[model samples]
Target chain A: MAKNEIKYLTAIKADKRVKKFCRFKKYKIRYIDYKDVEFLKKFLNEQGKLLPRRLSGNSLKFQRKVSDAVKKARQMSLLPYVTDLLK
Target chain B: MQLLQDLKLLIIILLKMELSAITGFLLAITNNQKSFKNDPLSLGLNSYLCRPKSVFADSFRTMRNVHWDKPPSQMLWRINRILNLPAIAFAKAGLKQKGKMNNYELMVIFTPVLSDDEFKAEQKKYAKLITDAGGSIVAENPWGLKSLAYPIQKKTTGLYWVLQYTAASDFNEKLKIQLLRDEAALRHLCTKLDKYAVEYNARKKSGAKTGTEKLAEV
Candidate 1:
């Protein structure tokens, strides 16, 4: 929790990558927390474009499962098809 | 008195004619039978002469008239006939490779009576069988212990598990036979999913953002 502690964000250069990729993809990162519903809503707003499997460094099998879970969440209205502009 | 009687009789006749007209109209719409725009008198006479036949008879006739001996018109009627023909032939084929049929979906309901470890063992066993049977498991999740919607063998609470898989027809037939023999599976139902349902579901899952980016909160 210390200011100078080595963070996961530092390890992945997460913020730098987010900024760099968002600009390239023309996506607006509503939030950086991937598990956050707000971040998912922002992702859905861009339509079907999902996180690159390599960037997540996840196994392809696990990535596929995750992708499918996300879709099921969206259809159930747990994730919105569009971002709430005010949020 | 005779005048009054005649008026009553006229009213009854009119009511009967109106009923016949309404019946004919409904019959035409439902059966896609060409409408008989004839007066009630004619319609009623036809009904009287030949016990009212459903206009569905027309479609039934078209189904039967497809002669293998002659060239089909290759038009809408032929198309309609072709579509209608499959259900009978498919039904006769008897669920062989039914799981492989396009749009087929299997809903496997698992109710395990064993402890968690035993259940996991059973899950692994069935999961392998499902894959080996040429069905791809699509969605699986625990519904937890719950009561059945209705009493099956006088049991109330059951451990609920659901599996959605797509399989080929013969695979399904084989799976169904296996399930019948398997003791762990309490009840199972297989229903074909519609094309639109599958497409909509796939689109909904294409991109989802959910995973812990940081260490556990606690």
Candidate 2:
């Protein structure tokens, strides 16, 4: 892929809603672009299907909301819900 | 009669200038001259005593008529337990309280991958860990899957578990150590419950038990 061609998955993660919530919550987005989705997905697989609060740096209330959103995106083929792709 | 005199003397010394009203109220309630239990007037005063600025609010609110000629330790524990209820109530009502405290409430969240069996097993392990460390298990509720503020371990939705327990000070550190080591634990929080809150709970349970008994009789 050309450098100028942005990764679609990365763009979704950096979407305004995602960034705004993450920024407000002081969480660092690890995926730079769609190119890194596979890497991030692998890391998540390692943590099991659910993520820990410290790594995500989200309050309990917001953490639940974000987890649901991730699952929804996975079901819609927006994101990979399982670990097979990363492996 | 002599015991009452000794109690009066003790209250006079312990309470100083407030002895008169305290003594009068005790006599009124204990003699059944007036039923302080569920008395609206006393309830109003009790509420007033709950305010932050009342100088002796805690003492005034918690003081009970004891046979003072008896050991102080017995009276102290009884009153302390009585006082614990309102303290918890105050905290639940969002009032900050002062004292050296012991906290026992805990919340634990887990990832979604674990099956019901796995979750129950972990819950049992954690409960045992808590009680072994001198905590009491209050309740454990499964909150089902919920969304996160951000993705974790790559996925978003995760299984949720809430556990309420009463434990000692060191229990927090012990639990955290095990949680960090376990891959299943996503998040956990522990908050201290005031002793007064515990007392309030006991009184509530007693009231509920009586109400149930009354219903059964009818």
Candidate 3:
């Protein structure tokens, strides 16, 4: 606990930007469709893995739907189960 | 006394808004509503709500190898039997959803070598196959020559046709067999649509655009 370190901590600032919200809830979407490939892709990373709820800005309820849709899309070949980084 | 209290809590939840729909679905199936019985859950929940004790006893009888030497373990086993009622019903329902028409959607990729007339005829033939088998086609969308996300059968592009239909649970097997026999089909997938999916597809066809669909236009 140095006095000089306390002075340096004053540079920290609170973020004022708007927080992320669940897109499905904002739009009142009751269903997540696997056939809607482009929409499902938004919830996947470059490696084609499902993005976590924290990263995707989705709530727990909507996150479940998203994961279910992603898996179904993979099964139907609407989306890749995995992708190469180069691709 | 604890069991009664738990049932009371369950009843209160059933009466509330959160589970009313689920309770209503259960009640409808219990009443033997034909249309509602299409969902596999309806059967399980039906038996569960109407005669849980009978199912519990039957299922427990099948699992009867548990040693009855200890009284405390026997008491715990009784509790476990009560907890397994819904699970047993669901297991049985999952296996036998026959003679019930439920929502289904089929997607097929036809080889790109087909002529325009051939494509039309092929789509019509499949549609007829569904109707002739006592099922109804809700919508038939021909996406027409879309590039595959990955190479399928060494082809980079395919004719994508999607069909939404309601049929008995076993009917998809017959459709899959037919698709396999048809040399023109490159790939095929048939999926069972839950209630939400049925509503979503209906809404999509009714000109209510989903978010991605609107973005696709731009």
Question: How much lDDT does each candidate structure score?
Answer: 0.45, 0.52, 0.68
> Reference contacts recovered by each candidate, as fractions?
0.00, 0.00, 0.46
Candidate 3, B1-218: lDDT as tens digits: 33443354355445553433356333542433344324445433434433323323332222222222334234333333545443344344332222458899888999888989999999999999999988999999999998776777788788989999998777888898999999999888888888878878888899786554542332
> Which digits, one per residue and each the tens of the lDDT, describe model 2 over residues A13-71?
54454322332134332112111234234325543365676665556665664565455
- The global Cα lDDT (0 to 1) of model 3 is 0.68
Q: For candidate 2, lDDT tens digit of each residue in B1-218?
A: 54555465456546656434454445434533335543544434544443445444444333433323334334333333554445554553333433333645555667888888998898899989977866678766676677654576686777766566766565688788998888997766554555543453444446642121221221
Number of the top TM-score candidate: 3
lDDT string for model 1 (B50-71, tens) is 2213322232223223322222
The DockQ-derived docking category for candidate 3 is: acceptable
Best candidate, DockQ = 3
TM-score of 1: 0.33
- What TM-score does chain A of model 1 get? 0.40
Native interface contact recovery, model 1: 0.00
Give all TM-scores, in the order shown: 0.33, 0.34, 0.58
